[model samples]
Target: MTEPAFLVLTALVDEPRHGYGVVREVEELSGGRVRLKIGTLYGVLDRLVADGLVELDREEIARGRLRRYYRLTEDGASALEAEAARLAANARSATERLAARSGRAKALGGLA
Candidate 1:
Protein backbone atom coordinates (compact mmCIF):
# COMPACT_ATOMS: atom_id res chain seq x y z
CA MET A 1 0.00 0.00 0.00
CA THR A 2 3.06 2.24 0.21
CA GLU A 3 6.02 3.03 -2.00
CA PRO A 4 7.93 -0.16 -1.28
CA ALA A 5 4.85 -2.31 -1.62
CA PHE A 6 3.93 -0.60 -4.86
CA LEU A 7 7.44 -0.99 -6.18
CA VAL A 8 7.53 -4.66 -5.26
CA LEU A 9 4.16 -5.33 -6.81
CA THR A 10 5.10 -3.46 -9.95
CA ALA A 11 8.27 -5.48 -10.24
CA LEU A 12 6.31 -8.68 -9.92
CA VAL A 13 3.81 -7.63 -12.54
CA ASP A 14 5.79 -9.00 -15.46
CA GLU A 15 6.53 -12.42 -14.00
CA PRO A 16 6.84 -14.47 -10.86
CA ARG A 17 10.09 -14.00 -8.96
CA HIS A 18 11.85 -15.09 -5.86
CA GLY A 19 12.54 -12.68 -3.01
CA TYR A 20 16.05 -11.74 -4.13
CA GLY A 21 14.85 -11.28 -7.68
CA VAL A 22 12.10 -8.96 -6.53
CA VAL A 23 14.59 -6.92 -4.50
CA ARG A 24 16.98 -6.62 -7.39
CA GLU A 25 14.22 -5.68 -9.81
CA VAL A 26 12.87 -3.00 -7.52
CA GLU A 27 16.31 -1.52 -6.99
CA GLU A 28 16.97 -1.46 -10.69
CA LEU A 29 13.62 0.12 -11.45
CA SER A 30 14.24 2.76 -8.80
CA GLY A 31 17.73 3.47 -10.14
CA GLY A 32 19.24 1.95 -6.99
CA ARG A 33 17.21 4.17 -4.71
CA VAL A 34 15.12 1.47 -3.08
CA ARG A 35 17.53 -1.29 -2.20
CA LEU A 36 15.58 -3.49 0.13
CA LYS A 37 17.18 -5.37 2.97
CA ILE A 38 16.51 -9.09 3.33
CA GLY A 39 14.47 -8.62 6.47
CA THR A 40 12.43 -5.87 4.91
CA LEU A 41 11.72 -7.95 1.86
CA TYR A 42 10.51 -10.93 3.87
CA GLY A 43 8.38 -8.71 6.09
CA VAL A 44 6.68 -7.09 3.15
CA LEU A 45 6.32 -10.43 1.40
CA ASP A 46 4.72 -11.99 4.43
CA ARG A 47 2.20 -9.21 4.69
CA LEU A 48 1.42 -9.33 1.00
CA VAL A 49 1.01 -13.09 1.04
CA ALA A 50 -1.21 -12.94 4.07
CA ASP A 51 -3.36 -10.29 2.47
CA GLY A 52 -3.88 -12.52 -0.58
CA LEU A 53 -2.15 -10.07 -2.91
CA VAL A 54 0.83 -12.35 -3.39
CA GLU A 55 1.00 -16.12 -3.09
CA LEU A 56 3.59 -18.84 -2.90
CA ASP A 57 3.28 -19.73 -6.51
CA ARG A 58 6.13 -22.16 -7.00
CA GLU A 59 9.41 -23.55 -5.80
CA GLU A 60 12.44 -24.68 -7.71
CA ILE A 61 15.89 -25.92 -6.94
CA ALA A 62 18.60 -24.35 -8.98
CA ARG A 63 22.30 -24.57 -8.30
CA GLY A 64 21.56 -26.44 -5.11
CA ARG A 65 19.58 -23.56 -3.64
CA LEU A 66 15.91 -23.48 -2.86
CA ARG A 67 14.16 -20.72 -4.71
CA ARG A 68 10.59 -19.87 -3.84
CA TYR A 69 8.73 -17.94 -6.47
CA TYR A 70 5.91 -15.57 -5.74
CA ARG A 71 3.20 -14.48 -8.10
CA LEU A 72 0.64 -11.75 -7.78
CA THR A 73 -2.99 -12.85 -7.71
CA GLU A 74 -5.74 -11.22 -9.73
CA ASP A 75 -6.69 -9.19 -6.67
CA GLY A 76 -3.09 -8.14 -6.31
CA ALA A 77 -2.97 -6.83 -9.84
CA SER A 78 -6.13 -4.82 -9.28
CA ALA A 79 -4.80 -3.44 -6.01
CA LEU A 80 -1.55 -2.34 -7.59
CA GLU A 81 -3.39 -0.53 -10.36
CA ALA A 82 -5.58 1.23 -7.84
CA GLU A 83 -2.60 2.33 -5.79
CA ALA A 84 -0.84 3.58 -8.90
CA ALA A 85 -3.86 5.64 -9.93
CA ARG A 86 -4.13 7.10 -6.44
CA LEU A 87 -0.49 8.13 -6.43
CA ALA A 88 -0.77 9.62 -9.90
CA ALA A 89 -3.79 11.65 -8.86
CA ASN A 90 -1.94 12.98 -5.82
CA ALA A 91 1.06 13.92 -7.95
CA ARG A 92 -1.15 15.74 -10.44
CA SER A 93 -2.81 17.71 -7.63
CA ALA A 94 0.54 18.72 -6.20
CA THR A 95 1.81 19.82 -9.60
CA GLU A 96 -1.29 21.95 -10.15
CA ARG A 97 -0.90 23.61 -6.77
CA LEU A 98 2.74 24.38 -7.43
CA ALA A 99 1.91 25.85 -10.85
CA ALA A 100 -0.74 28.08 -9.29
CA ARG A 101 1.72 29.24 -6.67
CA SER A 102 4.31 30.01 -9.29
CA GLY A 103 1.77 32.04 -11.27
CA ARG A 104 0.86 33.99 -8.13
CA ALA A 105 4.50 34.75 -7.39
CA LYS A 106 5.08 35.95 -10.98
CA ALA A 107 1.97 38.13 -10.87
CA LEU A 108 3.27 39.71 -7.64
CA GLY A 109 6.49 40.74 -9.46
CA GLY A 110 8.50 38.02 -7.77
CA LEU A 111 10.79 35.37 -9.35
CA ALA A 112 9.18 32.78 -11.59
Candidate 2:
Protein backbone atom coordinates (compact mmCIF):
# COMPACT_ATOMS: atom_id res chain seq x y z
CA MET A 1 0.00 0.00 0.00
CA THR A 2 1.08 3.55 -0.56
CA GLU A 3 1.89 5.69 2.46
CA PRO A 4 -1.24 7.79 1.97
CA ALA A 5 -3.43 4.76 1.61
CA PHE A 6 -1.92 3.12 4.66
CA LEU A 7 -2.35 6.24 6.71
CA VAL A 8 -5.92 6.72 5.49
CA LEU A 9 -6.83 3.17 6.47
CA THR A 10 -5.16 3.64 9.81
CA ALA A 11 -7.06 6.86 10.40
CA LEU A 12 -10.35 5.05 9.91
CA VAL A 13 -9.44 2.21 12.24
CA ASP A 14 -11.11 3.76 15.26
CA GLU A 15 -14.14 5.50 13.78
CA PRO A 16 -15.69 6.75 10.61
CA ARG A 17 -14.62 10.20 9.53
CA HIS A 18 -15.47 12.80 6.96
CA GLY A 19 -12.99 14.01 4.39
CA TYR A 20 -11.59 16.79 6.56
CA GLY A 21 -11.49 14.53 9.56
CA VAL A 22 -9.52 11.92 7.65
CA VAL A 23 -7.11 14.54 6.47
CA ARG A 24 -6.54 15.80 10.02
CA GLU A 25 -6.16 12.32 11.44
CA VAL A 26 -3.69 11.34 8.73
CA GLU A 27 -1.59 14.40 9.43
CA GLU A 28 -1.58 13.66 13.14
CA LEU A 29 -0.87 9.99 12.63
CA SER A 30 2.11 10.80 10.42
CA GLY A 31 3.33 13.44 12.87
CA GLY A 32 2.63 16.16 10.32
CA ARG A 33 4.67 14.39 7.67
CA VAL A 34 1.61 13.70 5.47
CA ARG A 35 -0.61 16.66 4.95
CA LEU A 36 -3.24 15.57 2.48
CA LYS A 37 -4.90 17.98 0.15
CA ILE A 38 -8.68 17.83 -0.23
CA GLY A 39 -8.49 16.46 -3.76
CA THR A 40 -5.91 13.88 -2.86
CA LEU A 41 -7.92 12.77 0.14
CA TYR A 42 -10.97 12.15 -2.06
CA GLY A 43 -8.85 10.31 -4.61
CA VAL A 44 -7.58 7.92 -1.99
CA LEU A 45 -11.05 7.53 -0.58
CA ASP A 46 -12.46 6.74 -3.97
CA ARG A 47 -9.77 4.13 -4.64
CA LEU A 48 -10.26 2.51 -1.27
CA VAL A 49 -13.99 2.39 -1.81
CA ALA A 50 -13.47 0.76 -5.18
CA ASP A 51 -10.98 -1.74 -3.69
CA GLY A 52 -13.40 -2.80 -0.92
CA LEU A 53 -10.94 -1.63 1.68
CA VAL A 54 -13.12 1.25 2.80
CA GLU A 55 -16.80 2.04 2.63
CA LEU A 56 -19.04 4.99 2.82
CA ASP A 57 -20.48 4.92 6.29
CA ARG A 58 -22.85 7.85 5.99
CA GLU A 59 -23.44 11.29 4.62
CA GLU A 60 -24.45 14.40 6.48
CA ILE A 61 -24.98 17.99 5.66
CA ALA A 62 -23.58 20.67 7.84
CA ARG A 63 -23.05 24.32 6.90
CA GLY A 64 -24.88 23.72 3.66
CA ARG A 65 -22.40 21.16 2.33
CA LEU A 66 -22.45 17.41 2.10
CA ARG A 67 -20.04 15.50 4.28
CA ARG A 68 -19.33 11.87 3.46
CA TYR A 69 -17.97 9.71 6.23
CA TYR A 70 -15.81 6.69 5.56
CA ARG A 71 -14.98 3.65 7.64
CA LEU A 72 -12.44 0.87 7.26
CA THR A 73 -13.48 -2.61 6.17
CA GLU A 74 -12.18 -5.86 7.63
CA ASP A 75 -9.95 -6.30 4.63
CA GLY A 76 -8.53 -2.84 5.11
CA ALA A 77 -7.57 -3.60 8.68
CA SER A 78 -5.87 -6.78 7.61
CA ALA A 79 -4.02 -5.01 4.83
CA LEU A 80 -2.92 -2.26 7.20
CA GLU A 81 -1.69 -4.81 9.69
CA ALA A 82 0.34 -6.58 7.03
CA GLU A 83 1.79 -3.34 5.71
CA ALA A 84 2.76 -2.25 9.20
CA ALA A 85 4.53 -5.52 9.81
CA ARG A 86 6.40 -5.25 6.54
CA LEU A 87 7.51 -1.72 7.37
CA ALA A 88 8.60 -2.78 10.83
CA ALA A 89 10.65 -5.61 9.45
CA ASN A 90 12.33 -3.31 6.96
CA ALA A 91 13.13 -0.85 9.74
CA ARG A 92 14.61 -3.58 11.89
CA SER A 93 16.81 -4.73 9.06
CA ALA A 94 18.11 -1.20 8.50
CA THR A 95 18.68 -0.68 12.21
CA GLU A 96 20.64 -3.90 12.53
CA ARG A 97 22.81 -3.08 9.54
CA LEU A 98 23.47 0.43 10.83
CA ALA A 99 24.42 -0.91 14.23
CA ALA A 100 26.82 -3.36 12.65
CA ARG A 101 28.32 -0.56 10.58
CA SER A 102 28.72 1.61 13.67
CA GLY A 103 30.46 -1.21 15.46
CA ARG A 104 32.85 -1.64 12.56
CA ALA A 105 33.51 2.08 12.49
CA LYS A 106 34.23 2.11 16.19
CA ALA A 107 36.66 -0.76 15.79
CA LEU A 108 38.34 1.11 12.97
CA GLY A 109 38.86 4.25 15.08
CA GLY A 110 35.70 5.99 13.86
CA LEU A 111 36.70 5.90 10.19
CA ALA A 112 33.03 5.86 9.11
Candidate 3:
Protein backbone atom coordinates (compact mmCIF):
# COMPACT_ATOMS: atom_id res chain seq x y z
CA MET A 1 0.00 0.00 0.00
CA THR A 2 1.07 3.53 -0.66
CA GLU A 3 2.06 5.68 2.28
CA PRO A 4 -1.01 7.82 1.93
CA ALA A 5 -3.29 4.82 1.71
CA PHE A 6 -1.69 3.19 4.70
CA LEU A 7 -1.95 6.36 6.74
CA VAL A 8 -5.55 6.87 5.71
CA LEU A 9 -6.46 3.36 6.75
CA THR A 10 -4.62 3.82 10.02
CA ALA A 11 -6.43 7.08 10.65
CA LEU A 12 -9.74 5.29 10.41
CA VAL A 13 -8.70 2.47 12.71
CA ASP A 14 -10.17 3.99 15.85
CA GLU A 15 -13.37 5.44 14.43
CA PRO A 16 -15.03 7.00 11.45
CA ARG A 17 -13.91 10.47 10.45
CA HIS A 18 -14.87 13.15 8.01
CA GLY A 19 -12.52 14.30 5.28
CA TYR A 20 -10.91 17.07 7.29
CA GLY A 21 -10.72 14.85 10.30
CA VAL A 22 -8.92 12.20 8.31
CA VAL A 23 -6.51 14.81 7.02
CA ARG A 24 -5.61 15.99 10.50
CA GLU A 25 -5.35 12.47 11.85
CA VAL A 26 -3.08 11.42 9.03
CA GLU A 27 -0.83 14.38 9.61
CA GLU A 28 -0.65 13.59 13.29
CA LEU A 29 -0.06 9.89 12.69
CA SER A 30 2.78 10.62 10.32
CA GLY A 31 4.30 13.14 12.75
CA GLY A 32 3.57 15.98 10.33
CA ARG A 33 5.43 14.27 7.52
CA VAL A 34 2.18 13.99 5.59
CA ARG A 35 -0.11 16.88 5.03
CA LEU A 36 -2.92 15.87 2.74
CA LYS A 37 -4.75 18.43 0.72
CA ILE A 38 -8.49 18.30 0.22
CA GLY A 39 -8.25 17.02 -3.33
CA THR A 40 -5.75 14.30 -2.51
CA LEU A 41 -7.76 13.24 0.52
CA TYR A 42 -10.88 12.71 -1.57
CA GLY A 43 -8.98 10.90 -4.25
CA VAL A 44 -7.58 8.46 -1.75
CA LEU A 45 -10.98 8.05 -0.14
CA ASP A 46 -12.59 7.33 -3.47
CA ARG A 47 -10.01 4.70 -4.25
CA LEU A 48 -10.38 3.07 -0.86
CA VAL A 49 -14.13 3.04 -1.22
CA ALA A 50 -13.82 1.44 -4.64
CA ASP A 51 -11.37 -1.13 -3.27
CA GLY A 52 -13.78 -2.15 -0.48
CA LEU A 53 -11.29 -1.01 2.13
CA VAL A 54 -13.41 1.82 3.46
CA GLU A 55 -17.12 2.55 3.68
CA LEU A 56 -19.29 5.48 4.38
CA ASP A 57 -20.31 5.43 7.98
CA ARG A 58 -22.61 8.41 8.04
CA GLU A 59 -23.25 11.97 6.94
CA GLU A 60 -23.85 14.95 9.14
CA ILE A 61 -24.37 18.62 8.72
CA ALA A 62 -22.03 20.72 10.75
CA ARG A 63 -22.12 24.52 10.37
CA GLY A 64 -24.15 24.11 7.15
CA ARG A 65 -21.53 21.77 5.67
CA LEU A 66 -22.06 18.12 4.97
CA ARG A 67 -19.49 15.88 6.56
CA ARG A 68 -19.17 12.40 5.15
CA TYR A 69 -17.59 10.10 7.66
CA TYR A 70 -15.63 7.06 6.60
CA ARG A 71 -14.69 3.91 8.47
CA LEU A 72 -12.19 1.18 7.74
CA THR A 73 -13.40 -2.23 6.74
CA GLU A 74 -12.11 -5.47 8.20
CA ASP A 75 -10.05 -6.01 5.10
CA GLY A 76 -8.56 -2.57 5.40
CA ALA A 77 -7.44 -3.22 8.94
CA SER A 78 -5.87 -6.49 7.90
CA ALA A 79 -4.12 -4.81 5.00
CA LEU A 80 -2.83 -2.03 7.22
CA GLU A 81 -1.55 -4.55 9.75
CA ALA A 82 0.31 -6.44 7.05
CA GLU A 83 1.77 -3.28 5.58
CA ALA A 84 2.94 -2.11 9.01
CA ALA A 85 4.64 -5.44 9.62
CA ARG A 86 6.35 -5.29 6.26
CA LEU A 87 7.63 -1.78 6.94
CA ALA A 88 8.84 -2.75 10.39
CA ALA A 89 10.72 -5.73 9.01
CA ASN A 90 12.35 -3.60 6.36
CA ALA A 91 13.39 -1.05 8.98
CA ARG A 92 14.82 -3.74 11.20
CA SER A 93 16.86 -5.17 8.34
CA ALA A 94 18.34 -1.79 7.50
CA THR A 95 19.05 -0.99 11.15
CA GLU A 96 20.78 -4.31 11.65
CA ARG A 97 22.95 -3.84 8.59
CA LEU A 98 23.85 -0.32 9.63
CA ALA A 99 24.76 -1.53 13.12
CA ALA A 100 26.94 -4.28 11.71
CA ARG A 101 28.68 -1.78 9.44
CA SER A 102 29.27 0.54 12.37
CA GLY A 103 30.69 -2.32 14.42
CA ARG A 104 33.05 -3.24 11.62
CA ALA A 105 34.18 0.34 11.23
CA LYS A 106 34.78 0.65 14.95
CA ALA A 107 36.80 -2.57 15.04
CA LEU A 108 38.87 -1.27 12.11
CA GLY A 109 39.50 2.03 13.95
CA GLY A 110 37.07 3.88 11.66
CA LEU A 111 38.79 2.65 8.49
CA ALA A 112 36.11 0.22 7.33
Candidate 4:
Protein backbone atom coordinates (compact mmCIF):
# COMPACT_ATOMS: atom_id res chain seq x y z
CA MET A 1 0.00 0.00 0.00
CA THR A 2 1.05 3.57 -0.65
CA GLU A 3 1.93 5.98 2.14
CA PRO A 4 -1.22 7.99 1.64
CA ALA A 5 -3.38 4.88 1.73
CA PHE A 6 -1.65 3.64 4.86
CA LEU A 7 -2.00 7.01 6.51
CA VAL A 8 -5.68 7.16 5.64
CA LEU A 9 -6.24 3.73 7.13
CA THR A 10 -4.39 4.76 10.26
CA ALA A 11 -6.57 7.82 10.59
CA LEU A 12 -9.77 5.77 10.38
CA VAL A 13 -8.66 3.02 12.73
CA ASP A 14 -10.09 4.80 15.74
CA GLU A 15 -13.47 5.77 14.35
CA PRO A 16 -15.44 6.78 11.31
CA ARG A 17 -14.83 10.19 9.78
CA HIS A 18 -16.07 12.46 7.08
CA GLY A 19 -13.91 13.48 4.16
CA TYR A 20 -12.61 16.64 5.79
CA GLY A 21 -12.20 14.88 9.09
CA VAL A 22 -10.07 12.21 7.50
CA VAL A 23 -7.92 14.88 5.90
CA ARG A 24 -7.30 16.58 9.22
CA GLU A 25 -6.72 13.38 11.14
CA VAL A 26 -4.28 12.08 8.57
CA GLU A 27 -2.23 15.25 8.88
CA GLU A 28 -2.24 14.94 12.65
CA LEU A 29 -1.41 11.22 12.67
CA SER A 30 1.47 11.77 10.31
CA GLY A 31 2.73 14.71 12.40
CA GLY A 32 1.95 17.09 9.54
CA ARG A 33 3.92 14.98 7.07
CA VAL A 34 0.77 14.32 5.06
CA ARG A 35 -1.59 17.06 4.05
CA LEU A 36 -4.19 15.59 1.73
CA LYS A 37 -6.05 17.83 -0.65
CA ILE A 38 -9.75 17.12 -1.16
CA GLY A 39 -9.38 15.93 -4.75
CA THR A 40 -6.56 13.54 -4.01
CA LEU A 41 -8.27 12.30 -0.89
CA TYR A 42 -11.48 11.42 -2.72
CA GLY A 43 -9.54 9.50 -5.33
CA VAL A 44 -7.85 7.42 -2.69
CA LEU A 45 -11.14 6.97 -0.86
CA ASP A 46 -12.79 5.74 -4.00
CA ARG A 47 -10.07 3.19 -4.57
CA LEU A 48 -10.19 2.02 -0.97
CA VAL A 49 -13.95 1.72 -1.04
CA ALA A 50 -13.81 -0.31 -4.22
CA ASP A 51 -11.16 -2.57 -2.72
CA GLY A 52 -13.50 -3.31 0.27
CA LEU A 53 -11.06 -1.72 2.67
CA VAL A 54 -13.54 1.01 3.55
CA GLU A 55 -17.28 1.43 3.67
CA LEU A 56 -19.69 4.25 3.87
CA ASP A 57 -20.83 4.59 7.43
CA ARG A 58 -23.50 7.20 6.94
CA GLU A 59 -24.29 10.53 5.37
CA GLU A 60 -25.60 13.78 6.65
CA ILE A 61 -26.69 17.03 5.10
CA ALA A 62 -24.87 19.90 6.70
CA ARG A 63 -24.76 23.43 5.37
CA GLY A 64 -26.49 22.26 2.23
CA ARG A 65 -23.77 19.73 1.47
CA LEU A 66 -23.61 16.00 1.93
CA ARG A 67 -21.17 14.89 4.60
CA ARG A 68 -20.32 11.28 3.98
CA TYR A 69 -18.74 9.30 6.80
CA TYR A 70 -16.51 6.30 6.16
CA ARG A 71 -15.31 3.52 8.41
CA LEU A 72 -12.69 0.83 8.17
CA THR A 73 -14.13 -2.58 7.42
CA GLU A 74 -12.88 -5.84 8.91
CA ASP A 75 -10.78 -6.51 5.85
CA GLY A 76 -9.41 -3.01 6.02
CA ALA A 77 -8.23 -3.48 9.56
CA SER A 78 -6.52 -6.73 8.65
CA ALA A 79 -4.82 -5.15 5.66
CA LEU A 80 -3.61 -2.22 7.74
CA GLU A 81 -2.21 -4.54 10.38
CA ALA A 82 -0.32 -6.48 7.75
CA GLU A 83 1.08 -3.32 6.23
CA ALA A 84 2.19 -2.00 9.59
CA ALA A 85 4.02 -5.24 10.30
CA ARG A 86 5.75 -5.07 6.94
CA LEU A 87 6.92 -1.50 7.55
CA ALA A 88 8.12 -2.33 11.04
CA ALA A 89 10.14 -5.29 9.81
CA ASN A 90 11.76 -3.18 7.11
CA ALA A 91 12.68 -0.46 9.62
CA ARG A 92 14.15 -3.04 12.00
CA SER A 93 16.39 -4.39 9.25
CA ALA A 94 17.64 -0.91 8.37
CA THR A 95 18.34 -0.02 11.99
CA GLU A 96 20.25 -3.27 12.54
CA ARG A 97 22.41 -2.61 9.51
CA LEU A 98 23.15 0.92 10.65
CA ALA A 99 24.08 -0.26 14.15
CA ALA A 100 26.42 -2.83 12.70
CA ARG A 101 28.05 -0.22 10.48
CA SER A 102 28.48 2.15 13.42
CA GLY A 103 30.07 -0.62 15.47
CA ARG A 104 32.50 -1.39 12.68
CA ALA A 105 33.45 2.28 12.30
CA LYS A 106 34.07 2.60 16.04
CA ALA A 107 36.27 -0.51 16.11
CA LEU A 108 38.26 0.75 13.09
CA GLY A 109 38.69 4.15 14.68
CA GLY A 110 39.96 2.60 17.93
CA LEU A 111 42.45 0.48 15.97
CA ALA A 112 43.82 3.59 14.20
Q: Top lDDT: which candidate number?
A: 4
> Of the candidates shown, which would achieve the greatest TM-score relative to the real structure?
4
**Model 2 Cα lDDT, one tens digit per residue, 1-112:** 8899999999999999999999999999999999999899889888999999999999999999998899999988998999999999999999999999988889899554
Write model 1 residue lDDT over 1-112, tens digit each, in one string: 8788888899899999998999999999899999999999999999998899999989999899999999999999999999989989999999999999988988888543
TM-score of 4: 0.96
**What TM-score goes with each of the models?**
0.91, 0.92, 0.94, 0.96
Query: Sorted on lDDT, highest at the top, how do the candidates line up?
Result: 4, 3, 2, 1
What TM-score would you give candidate 3 relative to the actual structure?
A: 0.94
Any runs in candidate 4 off by more than 4 Å, and if so which?
none
lDDT of 1 at 78: 99
Better of 3 and 4 by lDDT: 4
Which lDDT tens digits does candidate 3 get at residues 1-112?
A: 8889999999999999999999999999999999999999999999999999999999999999898999999988888899999999999999999999998889899564
Itemize residue pairs with steric clashes in candidate 2.
none
lDDT of each: 0.93, 0.94, 0.94, 0.97
In candidate 1, clashing pairs total: 0
Error of 4 at 71 (Å): 0.2
lDDT of 4: 0.97
All models, RMSD in angstroms: 2.1, 2.0, 1.7, 0.8
